[model samples]
Target: SQKIEQNSEALNIQEGKTATLTCNYTNYSPAYLQWYRQDPGRGPVFLLLIRENEKEKRKERLKVTFDTTLKQSLFHITASQPADSATYLCALDMGSGYSTLTFGKGTMLLVSP
Candidate 1:
């Protein structure tokens, strides 16, 4: 079985600093990995996706890196702000008949001024 692990504790950072979140997994061979941002009382919004063959992917101030060899993924936000404060989640496809997504508990990030 595949398992995903993330920091259960909240990450606190000051505004204008880069925030790095980690996602670690074991016993899973995922074709791709996805990152999402979830606000309080709102569903998660897609952030970035990195394929197995791709080392990294970026969008605006967001960056995601997938290292299959290490079975880990790193999600980064540059020049983070208070608006960027949210719970970040990492998801993996189950790779079965249908599209089944397995998501982590998510890491909460707090950006203060």
Candidate 2:
């Protein structure tokens, strides 16, 4: 069975440091990997999208990587701040256009000052 997973444990980090989050999968192949941020009581906001053919993609202080060999993706936040604290989600889209995304349960990141 195909499935996606992210650490259910919350990641705690100090200000001015980097935070690393992991997403792993098994028995699944996705055309695109999408990362999103969701605040309390708010919907997820788009962060980064990495294609199956791409090794890595970066935007501003964030970076995302997709490794089909290992069937895993990593999401990173540099110089994390308290404002950056949120529930981070990883979703998969097969690029069928009409198909819905398969989303992970998301991991919580707490950046303390």
Best TM-score among the predictions, by candidate number: 2
For model 2, give the 10-residue run with minimal summed lDDT: 92-101
lDDT of each: 0.90, 0.92
RMSD of 1: 1.2
Clashes of each: 0, 0
RMSD of each: 1.2, 1.0
Cα error of candidate 2 at position 25, Å: 1.1
User: Tens digits of per-residue lDDT for model 1 on 1-113?
Assistant: 78999888999999999999999999966887889899999999988878788999989999998898899999999999999999999999755646577999999999999
- Clashes, model 1: 0
lDDT of 2 by residue, 5-102 (tens): 99989999999999999999887679899999999999999999999999999999999989999999999999998999999999988888864788
- Report the Cα lDDT for residue 2, model 1: 80
